[model samples]
Target: MIILAATPIGNLGDASRRLVEALETARVVAAEDTRVAQRLMQALGVENRPRLIALHDHNEREKSADLVELAREDDLLVLSDAGMPTVSDPGFHLVSAAIEAGVTVTAIPGPSAVLTALAVSGLPTDRFTFEGFLPRKAGERASALGSLADERRTMVFFESPNRLADSLRAMGHAFGGSRLVVVCRELTKLHEEVRRGTPEALAAWADDGVRGEIVVVVAGAVPRTVDLDTAVQEVLLLTATESLKDASASVAAATGLSRRTLYEAALRARTR
Candidate 1:
């Protein structure tokens, strides 16, 4: 059997009973960081010393098969530095390998920074997305955020402290300064803080130097209420008074639809 354990995100108290029991009896432990695993064991008062193996993003794929081989006979435990394994952390490859090798894989569910932040974000969470981390480069980040400008589901992203201010600023430009957002920092810890406001306001707050791990939750775009046929008619009405290009651009800008798409629709309208 292959057991995936979720360690505490920050607070040690959040560790589950099954996770401790798993750790105490396991023969081999594949950890993201061996030192962190040692620390967790100490904190949990777990005396059993399982043979710790480092399985991180840099080497998870490479080591998956070997770990699965060991699990064929004895139980092999998996853990990430925080939260559940394979959640923007390493463990996915191992899970897949275990399945292929006919090994039973299960999880000891516990703390999660993603769900925790989203629950307290004050945004509609019925439908949402977890965009692990944004690109480090400015252009890539802008392009990524711009692509999601029309996304109706709430979005979540993980970001480094140093880049938090810049990311929020870019989001303000892409999703707009008025878009609702919450910056969750050091969650489940003493310094835990959740700041809610527009991206612009949050960006300004980040300027004071935010610290620790950060999770950003942003409300999805509320598309214009205009339907497709109505939007096409509006384009036609504008084209009667202006050039097709100008009309399409104006309608597209107002409706938050693609300008080229609107232009093509306008041409079809002329034919029809």
Candidate 2:
């Protein structure tokens, strides 16, 4: 059996009773970081001496099979440095391997920085998408934010403190300066803060440079300042670089326009 456990993101007191019992009795555990696991065990006052193995992004693929074999004989516990494993953390490969081997896969749900930040974001929560982490490069990050300019569902993202300000400015460029945003810093921790403002305001805040784990929650998109003609022009602009079909689909997505209509318009523009 493979048990995916959720460790405390902050406030060790949030550790569940089941989590403690499981850690107390488990003979073997795979952790994102062996040292962090030991520290956690010490903090939780668990006396069990479980064999700890490293299972991070670097070795997850090569080590997943061996871990699965161990789970076949004994209950193998999987955990990350924080939150649930595989939510922008390591665990998917192991879970997939366990499933393929007919090993029972279960989870002990607990503290999640994403959900925690979203709940306090003061934004719509009924529909939201968790975009784990954005690309680091300026061009790529800008392109990523540009693609979401029309995302109507509330969007959540994990970002490092260093990149927070630049990301906010890039988001402002893509989604407009006045778009609503919430930056949750050191969530559930002593320095916990939830700053609410426009992307421009937050970008200015980031300019000051801050430290802590960060989660960004942005309000859902509003209607675009586009009409049928404007949407067709956007399709045409993209078609200069992207295939006509691809351009039509992209523009339609961004403008909530009809793909077929955009395609036909682009086709007619070519003839004229």
Candidate 3:
């Protein structure tokens, strides 16, 4: 069996009872950083010195098979430096390999930056999507945000402090300056701060620079309501530069209208 354990994001006291017990008994542990795992065990007062194996982004794919094989004989415990493994962290490939090999996989769930940030974000949490991390480059980031311009579910994203300002600036452009955003910094830590405002507001604040692990939660786009005739006209205009299918899909996505309805309306309008 393969055990994926969640580690505390910051506060050591948040470590669950099951996680500590797993650490104590596990014969082998695959960690994103072996050094960090060692430190964590020390911090938790766990005396058991399990064999530590490095299983990070650099080697997760290569090590998955071996890890699965190892698990066949003994429970293989997986840990990231912080939070749950394979959640924008290492362990996804290993879990997939384990599942494919018919190896049982289970999780010791605990702290999660994604869920922590979302819960404290004050945004609508009834429905949400975790966006992981944004592209590092400005152009790529913009293109990614642009694609999600019409996302209706509240969005969660992990971001580095250094790039937070620039990302927020691009978000202001893509998601609009007035869009509500929450920046959760150093969550569950000494300097934990949650700043809520428009993207433009937060962008300006982050321009001075910020620090610590960051999670940004943004309110979903307001659904656009448009009549079929108006939507069809918009689709027709886009068809001048895009395919009929592409144009219809784009307009439908933006307007929250049925793609088939838009396509048919635009098709009939084009015939006229």
Q: Which stretches in model 1 have alpha-carbon errors above 4 Å?
A: 230-271
Worst 10 residues of 2 by lDDT: 250-259
Which ranges in model 2 have alpha carbons more than 4 Å from their true place? 225-272
Better of 2 and 3 by lDDT: 3
Global lDDT of each model? Answer: 0.91, 0.92, 0.95
TM-score of 1: 0.85
Task: Estimate candidate 3's alpha-carbon lDDT, on a 0 to 1 scale.
Answer: 0.95
lDDT per residue as tens, model 1, 1-272: 88889999999999999999988888899999999999999999999999999999999889999999999889889999999999999999999989988999988899999999999888998999999999999999999998788677899999999999999999999988889989999999999999999877888889998899899999988868787778888898988789999888777766788879888987898898
Summed backbone clashes in each candidate are 0, 0, 0
As for model 3, its CA RMSD to the true structure in angstroms is 2.1
* Root-mean-square deviation (CA) per prediction: 5.7, 2.7, 2.1
Instruction: Rank by TM-score, highest first.
Output: 3, 2, 1
Top candidate on lDDT is 3
lDDT digits (tens) for residues 1-272 of candidate 3:
99999999999999999999999998999999999999999999999999999999999889899999999999999999999999999999999999999999999999999999999998999999999999999999999999899888999999999999999999999998899999999999999999999888898899998999999999999979999899999999999899999999988878899999999989998998
